[model samples]
Target: MVGVMRSCLRSLLKLMNSIIGMVGTGMILYSLWMIRLWHQHLDGGGSISQIPWFIYTFLGLGISLCLITCSGHIAAETANGHCLSCYMVFVFLVVLLEAAVTADVFLNRNWEEDFPEDPTGRFEEFKKFVRSNFEMCKWIGSLIVAAQALSILLAMILRALGPDRGGYYDSDDDYTPARLPLLKPPVQQPPYAVDSHFKLKNDVWNTNR
Candidate 1:
């Protein structure tokens, strides 16, 4: 039953990792598309250094996500304690970052002041998009956060119940008591044998005397 549960959790973690990889890939593609559009719009009017900073930011984020996704998948497949631990730490950091950003957005009235101005106005457009699709975005974000949280939990549990050195789950029953060694009976001899031998010797000695 424990093994089955571990297998299910591993499968779920792998699926979440796949989703994370897909999100990373999508971000990378979107950043590239944006760059292409920026190039076309500029038409050599601006130098390469003038490329928007958000593109690079998204690109970096996507690459980091891809790395984390790969780590998570490896951890899930191997079921190693160390791998699962590190994977959980990485995932926790990501969750913490997202939560911090979300809290800042909700609690800080002047959160926009923390960020530099974007000349391309893509940031404002992104905010508008979120506002327009608030319900969809909210559900999606909640699902993503839930998935990450669940993944971390599963990783921690699997780490606690990790495979042995041979890469196999130890099937020994923890509740069963160990068998004790059996006791052996002592060998027995006739009680009259020694007395009979002594009597025969005494009779012989008396006759000799």
Candidate 2:
């Protein structure tokens, strides 16, 4: 039972590590993609204002940094056998920072002055679309942060429970209760050599003879 529990805990830890690593790698890749896309847009005669460029650049850098931090945490956990709580906290911080940066980017967009050439036509339509999309992005960012926070909280709880509660890795010296022995079936005996009265009947017949 102890061995099984330990195996389960190890598997859980590995799964968590893999998930965080993938998320971090994805973040870095997405940031690079966004930067590349923006550059392409600029090259294609799209008049991207300096403000949006700055916002994109800032967000890209922030996401890159967060990914780096997450990677570092994962490496540290792998190398040092540290508690998963540390990684959880790191992830939580990264999520919170991401949320803040996203909010800032959306808020800093100047819809009123954007595309002034077409006063109530193209610019208004574009502004409405941007506003709606930005709001959606903001909600998405919030949900991501919320999910990260929940994961961190759960990791902390599992860490607190230790290996005894089927959490965390246990060392060889860890105390585990001995498993109870399995019950064995009762042994069957051959049928009695004869009925109880057989010996008495035999003795009476011998005396009569």
Candidate 3:
């Protein structure tokens, strides 16, 4: 019975992992599309639009990381044990960083204006702004960096707890057996028998007997 339960759990984990894989792949594709859009916007003198592009990039990255974390959770649950703490922490940190970036982008709309419009003054102003806002940008960047670092650490831990070093589901192995239940043979019943000595008490029955 315990083995059956374990087998069921493993099958469930594999299905969940497949779902996570699809989501991860979709996120990566979306990220690529966003990058292409950003480049087009830049070519069309839409540097201002890059803000949203950056936001989308960050969102895609966050989603990708989440899918990865989910995969890890499934693996851990099926093989070693379910420990979602690391995955949760990583997701929380990424969400916090994404929220901070979104807020910063909205709050500082004129941040792009900080850069000089004139080509000659562009480099100088860019440098000056970097120097002046170094502290603030550094803090924000640090938060994002910290979140990424934590996510990576969690992924590593999950991989270590996973069944394979590659940290992916074993596609080569037959999973159907894990999903099927054990069968038992049906009980047999005895055939009905009658006593030949028993007879009906009636006028027609007496003639027949």
Best by TM-score: 1
Clashes of each: 0, 0, 0
Q: Pick the candidate with the highest lDDT.
A: 1
Off by over 4 Å in 2: 1-30, 37-81, 95-130, 164-209
Which window of ten consecutive residues has the lowest lDDT sum in model 2? 114-123
Model 3 steric clash pairs: none
Q: Between candidates 1 and 3, which one is better according to lDDT?
A: 1
- For model 1, give the RMSD to the true fold: 8.1
Better of 1 and 2 by lDDT: 1
Model 2 error, position 179 (Å): 16
Clashing pairs in 2: none
Between the candidate structures 1 and 2, which one is better when assessed by TM-score? Answer: 1
lDDT of each: 0.81, 0.54, 0.53
Q: Write the residue-wise lDDT of candidate 3 on 87-176 in tens digits.
A: 445456656766785576569976666433432233344458767998987785565455445544544444444443233655635665
Please write out the lDDT profile of model 2 over residues 1-209, one tens digit for every residue.
66464445445545554554555566566556656766677788877544444334445655654564465445333322254655665676677776675566568685344323431133345447767798885675565555555556545544554444333645534543332223454577888677769889999999999
Error of 1 at 122 (Å): 1.6
